[model samples]
Target: MSDTAIRVTGRCRCEKNPVRFEYTKVPAEVHYCLCTDCTDISGGAMALIAVVERSTFRITQGESKIHNYDTKPTCHRRFCSECGCHMFLYVDAFPEHLLIHVPTLDRGQDIGAKPDRYVFVNSKLAWLTLPDDGLPRHQGWANSGAPVEV
Candidate 1:
């Protein structure tokens, strides 16, 4: 089935003024990001990102509670101002897409896509170990770089 036939919903961490969002199309790509910027801001060793087309994604609620933090000149990360949860972001390099944090999806909702690879593995934390899932590991962005030996 076409990914556009599926829909998924998500919300931010705020109890009273949650920032809600939904995407009707399947993501163009999904992967694990180990870039320091993503890992540092999210306080995790890695980040699961769903690259959804901007035209198919929308904020459904709490628009007034949304805030933008420019993690870099080319990256604008959006979060819920009330609860400070970073749920999505826009990258200048991928103007047509919005990168959604996978964990923001409502529990049990089919994410509509599976992570195909791990990117920025060269920046991965030393204490963390990659899983044996067999996904390709890239030293940088998946599109511009070659897979690295795991």
Candidate 2:
């Protein structure tokens, strides 16, 4: 599909004044994040994230209903005020991009990309076993320059 024609829509859990968002291009990167902050806040084993350019993303609705919480000094997570569903986050380390929770996207439509690797494996819970997906597993951030043994 043409770059400008490609669009993906997603929303928070709220039925009213839900936080709606859309992106016009394929994400730059997609990965499974095993960071403690992501897993703890999401209440999940890991977070599937799609890194998209800020210029291609837009909040279509519930702008006022979106609440931001600084998970840390560098990470500002935005969620729906009503449902408290975390939708996206801005990281100081990637100023030009936004990290979106993959599950927030409407099902049945292509997410425009596939997760290529796993990040923060160093912080992965010991009880959680990773799938034998053959994706590169990074010990830290994907670009952290740390060696991947598996």
Candidate 3:
């Protein structure tokens, strides 16, 4: 991972409100999630999430427009109420940070790197098959990597 930091900015689908997230430090990790829940929420096959500290994320405007859905007791997904754009998710396990979707960031902001592995492959639809290059595949979340400290 590079030591350099990059600024990431995003907004709702309508672009009415904007949020800025400064990745002051390179992410400890990044990954693609193919879980059913992720796919259902994103309306896509997978979700690209970048684990970032809460301190680095800021809602520059339209804070009230951000709505949250507590899917589980420990998991909360946030989105723009006006545009209904799913931007980030906050988990009780990592209360001090935000998991921002990489695709939501500004077009030019380099997302550091792509996911090195896939998680929740067991729940992935049978129609979808990832490349057989042999990256680590996990039935659920990967616990072998550095744990995110809350």
lDDT of 1 by residue, 14-115 (tens): 888689999999899999999999999999999999999999999999999999999999999998888889999999999999999999999897888999
Worst 10 residues of 3 by lDDT: 141-150
- Model 3 lDDT per residue over 1-150, tens place: 345566667666765345444456555567788877778999998888888877766777678878899877787998888777898898777778788888887787677666777777767787886776556777777773532211
Query: What lDDT score goes with residue 73 in model 2?
Result: 92
Better by TM-score, candidate 2 or 1: 1
Judging by lDDT against the true structure, name the best candidate: 1
Model 2, position 57: C-alpha lDDT score? 97
1 versus 3: better TM-score goes to: 1
- For model 2, the stretches where C-alpha displacement exceeds 4 angstroms are 1-5
What's the lDDT for residue 115 in model 2?
94
Cα deviation of 31 in candidate 2 (Å)? 0.6
Find the 10 residues in a row with the least total lDDT in model 2: 141-150
Model 3 residue 119 lDDT score: 73
RMSD of each: 1.3, 1.5, 4.8
